[model samples]
Target: SDYSQEPPRHPSLLINSKVPFNAEPPRSALASSYVTPVDLFYKRNHGPIPVVDDIERYCVDICSLIGTPKKLYMRDVRMLPKYNVTATLQCAGNRRTAMSKTRKVRGVGWDVSAIGNAVWGGAKLADVLELIGIPKLTCSTQSGGKHVEFVSIDKCKEENGGPYKASIRLSQATNPEADVLLAYEMNGKPLNRDHGYPLRVIVPGVIGARSVKWLDSINIIAEECQGFFMQKDYKMFPPSVDWDNINWSTRRPQMDFPVQSVICSLEDVQSIKPGKVTISGYAVSGGGRGIERVDVSIDGGKTWLEASRSQKTGVPYIADHVSSDKWAWVLFEVTVDIPYSTEIVAKAVDSAANVQPENVQDIWNLRGILNTSWHRVQVRVGQ
Candidate 1:
């Protein structure tokens, strides 16, 4: 009955804990202008939290290896037509504390706030897999299928193992730029219960344990996602492989999640009120290919400025104004003029040139998974 004591009302920034696989450190860690305030936006559970009683007896089982198994509910999926997505869910171990400082790797040691950027409304997992009929199999330009598997109702055991299941693929569950959702709501309302209330599965740009929460089943598979958190823990070895010369089948399960950025308004020991110090953060890139620019370095990367972005309404490439994937957050800013004894550092760079990995021991891996580097915070100027 330990639902992690269920109490994340809102405004969160915890980041890591292990009892039930916790994590939540990325609303940019709430600073740099803040806006991930959906109950602190970082809860990556793996087990024990399923207490769903009734969203009118919520269901959601739409299976398909070839087909058969339909189950709708939740008012037959909210009577369709409701697609609102303001993406960003990052957590391929979102910067696992820079790969646990290059070593000790296993799970849930996150430090980039596990990432968050809400606006996710609901309905549109390809219109509920074409209204649960599920048949859309085409793209055989010569048989080359590989992913599309999401199965979660939040069950677990492993460590002497038994239950736990997770999956993702089928070109990121049929990419329409990977909108892939079944979300009941978040940043709008409803899904609270440690965030898998009646439904969950947001898969934007992949990773975040394949975006599966209480969601029951969704398979379009060809392979990949055999479970065990996708073929034996989020694969990525090298840094001279550890955990017994790791070779978990030629390592590879971490679908798209590279260019990242963070530095959510200074705080290592915060205290700045001298002249000017207005740095900001939040940048993303993974499959969708949007975040075109976010470069801001304070004397650490030598010299880099250009950071003033924000524009996600109607998205027409910033539409003479709003264009960067609607549902917001590309936010950037800069304003420096420090003196009262310095020690500030910040870093970010996106838009596919994909910067960030400058440290973290050359992309440390052994299951710590893709920890986008450069996110230092240590300010002090006051007086």
Candidate 2:
């Protein structure tokens, strides 16, 4: 209960768990804005909230397998140039509840709202590398130091006496275009404890899990993070492979997620008035491949209509800074006649041509991760 230090959240968010708090905003309110308010943003944590006392003493260790290591204090990181990125962060299990409908899969049963967009301010990882030191990295199959690993400050039971950690390809961490950051602020304010006060890593275009919170150390290494999170979890497996016959190593850690969209409102089993009915929700693609289009169908997949995409606002500030990559998300709306009972379906196409699978069974896996299937809601359109 002392997790209250995380701050009181918007009462509208659906709380999936307490203690080590995890929750998501109401589906109807999730995509209502270009930048989700800090209070309404989704919260996902694996363990207790780590309190980093003495903000001045907070430090991030930068270790290099092939170069000298350095300790960058909070002030040191802040002294570096800051860049702002308006990006969306989604859990790998954003729509796990849908997948669970087909078969039981392990995870916090997240609805479709475990995602949000916000303006994050911090020093770019690439610029930090340049100002600090560049570790000699190699990509060879049998080589040394090809990855960048991160260790969190919060110890967790999930990792068995270890901190939650993750990693990315060395190039992904160092490439200026990748736009990774040591995010010190969320929106225009310093991060709240629940969101990694002091500092965290913002890995745009990747799953939220990759953006380690309470960032403690950055390490350049020859291998991917050896953390259990990177190895035993956050992976997908064929439905045929159950716990009895599963080989965790056979599957690669989930990196870029697939294209996905959802009809946030007008949910399943809801009764709607006949005549003109409106539908709206959010769509996003992973790996920096922006959503190209979102299609909604009222009578199942037989027919479709294009929803109006969220256009770049004419307003100034970093809103204008988001490039065509548009790593945030697209809020869409479409109004049409709903004369009878029908299944409302939504699917998104990413710039990479990745289309959401039409059914959860089509992409069903043992772990229920990456539930990017077309979102369908059966609603009765009477009265």
Candidate 3:
């Protein structure tokens, strides 16, 4: 593939791989704000970014296993209702770097910044499906359409140079409450090529893999997508399983990510004076679950303190509140006095009462995906 026409990236971003352009913003920058800036958003690409030069002529083909195909142009989609949905998209392998320490894992070596929250504007997929006689909440069509597949223009090695693709259940796609969108705008501005210029699928409360970018088509199928990403990659495997005796079909592709929390104010190892210190970071959960609370531990896992959580400034965060964006992340902070060197840790609890695991090894998988373990950082105090 030709890699000459790549888009410009933020200089502060830590580039993991250059060929397919996988980079993430600094950890501190990620937790500094509720909504991540577009430039600072993590970029996870499998192949060269495909450029869409002609916006007027761009269209997305929609078809099913046993129905006539339909095409929706950019103008056609824009004519529908526009919604500003604030959602957080987190990679399944968000904290793969920490997991690698326990055991070797495959895929990108990301820290804690492979996630971002943004307000996306676009027509609901339910509305778009309605245009073609598909009713809302339809699980299966008369012709046996059960899943909705998204095909992208970007080609990747995982697909053997074929277009990237993924899918979700038809019930999820047809449910307006799901907030599944065919997004065209990000943060009120038209999406840049790096983030899918013409169109993209925004599957809120799900792993970023299912939100395919640079969209080319949508297909209603009888079963889940059989693409490389859906079938082979992104699926979590048991820690005991290795490449020699791995069975791809044994596990389903990861959908919604687990409850996650990370400490971004300090690095893995840092030196500071013996005094009061402020710790802050991000907490989020999948499947529209809200963050109920965040627990901070100053002396390793001995004792814990409750941290304040908020989405908007000056507003108290309540789980599942009308004002709260259920799909977005909440920033947590707390202050404590440190008289000696100690280890700091942070863990989160979701609205469902699901708490993050205490140890990485407990949830450690061969793929290093879904490392929602307690975030720990070593602190060295000075006189």
Candidate 4:
């Protein structure tokens, strides 16, 4: 079936794009306070969504700058013990909308929901790398060598180009703590076409684009993949850079994502009964630091309070659940006594002591990449 044509509808967020992919539902749509359902998770695709059949026929090829190429068919790959992990896959451009507000940038205009956590089931990439002859290096030395590149079979009608490919540093590829995987299944079921049917790379702590879907090739290289996506796109630029003055080659690709968080509840102009109202959301830091805490402020950063991050105790509106690998996400909440007031604001921090930047202008780039800033929602307190 062409699942891409009939993408699943999600209730909790607003849809920003529909053809190439679907953005998250608006924060106001998150009625429930826990993990987002699999079907409802935001879908982001850059090309024609691929359809895969005959699992036995599926094959993944591994190559290197210095070694012989190796190929693994579906059966061969599945022979290895399967490992399951719940991880959050977030697009690098999750908050482009906020950045776009400061100045028009290129690419899909995503709101806060471009991220979703799911239980991924598959053979670990580390195991596959070992099978293909990656030497066992100490944890500290893993990042020392080169880069591990990934290519997708899913094709896009390039205005003028070849297939899509992306990669990450070898250090990131080999980190056991990163939990990179060749995910064949998502949320306990076979992957949907929109999400990469037969397989996709799941690089837990890197930008989502680096986790290429319809994964076909894995290469170990001494440098980042020189593909257009890596060489020319997804890079950060000074706030002073603009479309006309930009030099793409001078900037580096966004390999690791920055710490980011968002307020997923309450919408601008929404009204709530006066009294105690709870604010809740998710926070995560890329590159495997994990989120340590999320602070919430009701008065627009005038003061801050630690949002509850415990898994126990019924904190209404707070979703404190997290996955085992801690690669998924941290749901947090803070209850505030609202007098008949005018507006409310909230923000979060991660384990790296990285707090979301206060505004979009400071981090604006020509491509609108890496937009993690304080997410604020204005609401009215009713009498």
TM-score of each: 0.33, 0.94, 0.99, 0.88
| lDDT, model 1 | 0.66
lDDT of 4 by residue, 266-365 (tens): 7666788888888887777776666767777788778888887632235332322333346656677788887775555555565657777888888888
| Candidate 2 all-Cα RMSD | 2.9
Considering every candidate listed, which one attains the maximal lDDT?
3
Model 1: per-residue Cα lDDT over 1-383, one tens digit each: 25555554443456366557486654445544335767677787766777777667668777665546788787767787777787777778776756786577777776666777787788867667766454344332133445556666666765233334556655445545457778888878877877777778777766667777777766665666577777778777778888877777887677767777776776555777678778876777676666666666656666767777664433334412134563234766688786774544545544445666767778787778777777666666767
Model 2 per-residue lDDT tens digits across residues 242-328: 889988889888887778788887767789888887899888888777777889998899999998777456532122225443677
Superior candidate under TM-score, 1 versus 2: 2
lDDT of 3 by residue, 1-383 (tens): 98999999899999999999999999989999898999999999999999899888889999977657899999999999999999999999899999999888998999999999999999999999988888999989888999999999999988888999999999999999999999999998999888888899999999999999999999998999999999998988877888899999999989998899999899989899999999999999999999999999999989999999999998788987487998999999999998999999999999999999999998888888999999999999988
Residue 135 deviation, candidate 3, in Å?
A: 0.4
> Which ranges of candidate 2 are over 4 A from the true structure?
1-6, 135-143, 314-325
Q: Name the best candidate (by TM-score).
A: 3
Q: Which stretches of candidate 3 lie over 4 Å from their true place?
A: none
> Positional deviation of 376 in candidate 3, in angstroms?
0.6
Instruction: Please rank every candidate by TM-score, starting with the best.
Output: 3, 2, 4, 1
Could you list the CA RMSD of all candidates, in the order they appear?
18.5, 2.9, 0.9, 3.8
